[model samples]
Target: MTIHELSPQRSAALTGVIPPVSTPLTPDYEVDTASLTRLVDHLLAGGVDGLFVLGSTSEVAFLPDSHRKIVLDTVTHHVAGQVPVLAGVIDMTALRVLDHARVAVEAGVDGLVATAPFYTRTHPAEIELHFRTIAAQTGLPLYAYDLPVSVHSKLGGDLLLELASDGVLAGVKDSSGDEGALRGVILGRRDRRDIASFSVLTGSELTVETALWMGADGVVPGLGNVDPHGYARLFRAASNGDWEAARAEQERLLQLFELVNVGRPRMGLGSSALGAFKAALYLRGIIDHPTTAVPQIPLNDDEIARVGKYLSASGLL
Candidate 1:
């Protein structure tokens, strides 16, 4: 596959609500291309600025290489340049991540997102070298994913700024849930005269309004898969400086986020939350089956009912 390049103008437009889109699967755990296309259409119609595939919300870690390729191919082909498609090359090291990054680049993804290496104990200097090396090798716009819960490493604001200044990172996806760190990155981008157009997107769904107010360029909410229009409305409200409207919308979305808690006591955090997102999508008829990958428990009938209640209460059903 031939890798295409994105113009500076096109790369600069990577802002607003870009969902870490879920990878729909058949009962046999095969990639459901048709359903994935539908989901992309759903998000595009809802006014999202871009599509992020194979991220945490997409269950990238669980997907086999073939399934990951299927997802990247399907979304990139379907989107057809209507919006930027950012693919996540998540792995435990630079070499493995580069393999996936090559595939994404060949698939014509607008950019790549990856977190610091995991599984083995690594140093901050190593993490910096990891990103710098990947950026140099791929020659594609790279975004640092600060997902401490999953990656086990919190990408500090200082490192993030240094990367931006050095042109090693095009942006950052801060899911660390640390308000101080998030603010630091946002402020760093704002105050830095050398780094221009470094996007700082918040993956903190519960506080989209707050992140935006704190100078975040956009949001990559997992809940956006369930309620894309809602996030779109919230983004526009906040971006327009209408805090009152943004607050109301965000509060409603926060209520919707409560659905993730429905599976907490019985299932692991990933199982419960991801299953709820899939279940909600299934219940809304957006996808065929809510079945997640193996080893991760699926939401039972009772828990699925709770998801429906959340949608209904949010005026989605």
Candidate 2:
């Protein structure tokens, strides 16, 4: 069922470890459907509650529109509603975002995740209008993807809270890298919102335990592509109030997260991070080929070995 259906089960699907899945590509950089299926199965076996496709980690912007549809159709059909599927509509305008949203809906996603219009100057009013228009046009559960890194616009806690209260948003995926802002939104959701089911998920993998403690609903860690089981365990520990276990898990996961840094010396942040994830997955034998989309520099043999060391240290290998 779509998130708009709002059944008891649907309300609950928005919570827990929903990873922004990495896109697996063939050696020639096509969407590897077989590898994609295996990755989905790997995540399901790892006990993830849901999946967020076409996000930053998924290389949505680098993907041509055709490949984006391939990913949506492949994931949505393969998942078969085992869990809610939230797909990103990352674009530069509301109308352009709506174009992607239509495909997401056609592909059978349960919800839509979008960011503020980017590649141009925008005001808070335009940002709000962007989301409002998408929500009205799509009629799906709309999620605000607050990532200042790519969109270059920070969405404040106040605007998100207002949208949530206004019934234009179903939840938020805050990758804005602002911890204090995240806490403000979580607390506001807890204390001010009339709706009890509005989810507040953080993209900060390292601080997920603390975010949960502060009343955030769940997490969407890109690192989860390599270690979904670890993240799932951490979320459960936090949910059960075992702060000690949560911290231990978070620390271990942070160690695994160090792999992202291994490639930083030679590549841009996105390339290094994305390449490291694919290398880890390839080492784990999850995805057959670890070829990243161009022109993101692919990790060399040396970099892949470094990634293995990080995975080995974190018990991912």
Candidate 3:
């Protein structure tokens, strides 16, 4: 149960399409371990370079402590060092995040991903302090997650670079959708001599190709959970300098990404997207159920049909 060696060395750098994997749930909303194992197999079979558990796509914000532990344990145990498993320590504050990070480390994640503290107003200085404290306390490599929509505060490029230079962070998982800022981070790392081996991964699924073209190190596309092969192919094509093939693959994925919107009219954003992913997994027979966590609307039969259409159109069916 203790998988300490999975932690990345100081010099280790993560790259390629790492999916923020979905947490498969049963009808009663328990963490379906069998389904989760199958999901992990599905992604690995599709050739993903790494796996991210407890991320937004995995409904980290909604899961209780027990549920989160089950997810982390299941993923790391099943992965068994095959690929790096980055666990998200998403909570409302530094102390809470540290607690989660400790659990994740004990569970044997290769790295930790965290968003800026949310629910309470936070200043730039507090955000910097937050990461610095976590980095100092936990020896595991840490990646800052920039998700303004959920965290309510954007990680500024200056703050991020400062932390990177000080060795407080290994990289950033940017989902802020700010291309200019993303480019700045990419270029800053390139130009800074003090910052070493910082991996920049874009969480923007739709703009993955552009992010690559802009010199991003990798991608953490949530959609990769649904089609890891497509994202892996896209990453390979881009990394190999085949822009045309990469573009084609990216466009195809963009079309597939439209499934996230199918339930928007009847549910919240998380509900629609997560529901769509689970639905896709179910349709593919990768998971047993498509039920999302409570308080989030589940896709009705009609919405599920829309997901099917997107899958069939994308040749996944």
Candidate 4:
């Protein structure tokens, strides 16, 4: 299908939650479609604005292309228009990303969330060209995913505006965690407003309110994989300018994020953020097991105990 006029169809106005959903797997490590479907349905009921499938939390690197297609098709068909769907296209090469975007759109995705090309550090101009090329190829609204720590590209304000002027670049997921950098993008290049507008979304729980105050449209949080309802409420509070309520919810979510995230000293590097999320999911009885693909370890006993205690204290379980 030829696509044009790439305006965002997502809830990109910063008032709801969108979870980077986990890819449920069986004991043999095959993608468990039924479990994944149930998890998606559960989050939808919990009031998530949409689903970001095959995200970093989903271990997209572990799944082969064939498996990715299966998950994408299943999700798009099963969703049946209940909520918008965004497919993660995290690839090391622009050509590979373009192929993934084409297939995802054909499978009926509403939009695409593409990470900067990893495996190499490139100049800002190179990064802009890479994204512009991809956006030009696919008509889907492209969210510039600025996860510098993961993908090694820092999306600057001028570059963001440049991509936006080309029409395919829709908004940004500012996982950079730099409040100043996010604000620059939000305030940068107002002249390009004719092409499309950029919405800044944050990855750090520490800077969500800051991002929202700076005009972020919404969040694509990893923790939302397990705590959709809490995030939904939090987003609503932030949107309505309910600072007190939003602050309280942010504190609660930050606590949960720290307990499971590997960046915390209590957990260490070998830990899987994905596993910690699945552990929380199991506690909630949302999924059957905390399964991971090859080379990714499951959460240990101490980690499980820590998660259980934290969730209990927060009454999330």
User: Could you tell me which 10 consecutive residues in candidate 3 have the lowest summed lDDT?
Assistant: 1-10
Model 1 ranges off by over 4 Å: 1-13
What TM-score would candidate 4 get against the native? Answer: 0.90
Give the Å shift of residue 45 in candidate 1: 0.7
lDDT of 4 by residue, 29-147 (tens): 88888888888988898899888898877889899998899889888898998888889987997888877887898899878889777787787767877777777667777887888
**Candidate 2 — what's its lDDT?**
0.89
Number of clashing pairs per prediction, in order: 0, 0, 0, 1
> Residue 75 deviation, candidate 1, in Å?
0.5
Cα miss at 140, model 4 (Å)? 0.8
Error of 4 at 306 (Å): 2.4
Would you estimate the TM-scores of all the predictions? 0.96, 0.95, 0.96, 0.90
Q: Which window of ten consecutive residues has the lowest lDDT sum in model 1? A: 1-10
**Which stretches of candidate 4 lie above 4 Å from their native place?**
1-15, 189-192, 261-270
Cα distance off (Å), candidate 3, residue 241:
0.4
Clashing pairs in 3: none
- Measured over all alpha carbons after superposition, the RMSD of each candidate to the real structure, in angstroms, is 2.2, 2.9, 2.6, 2.9
- For model 2, the stretches where C-alpha displacement exceeds 4 angstroms are 1-13
Better of 1 and 2 by lDDT: 1
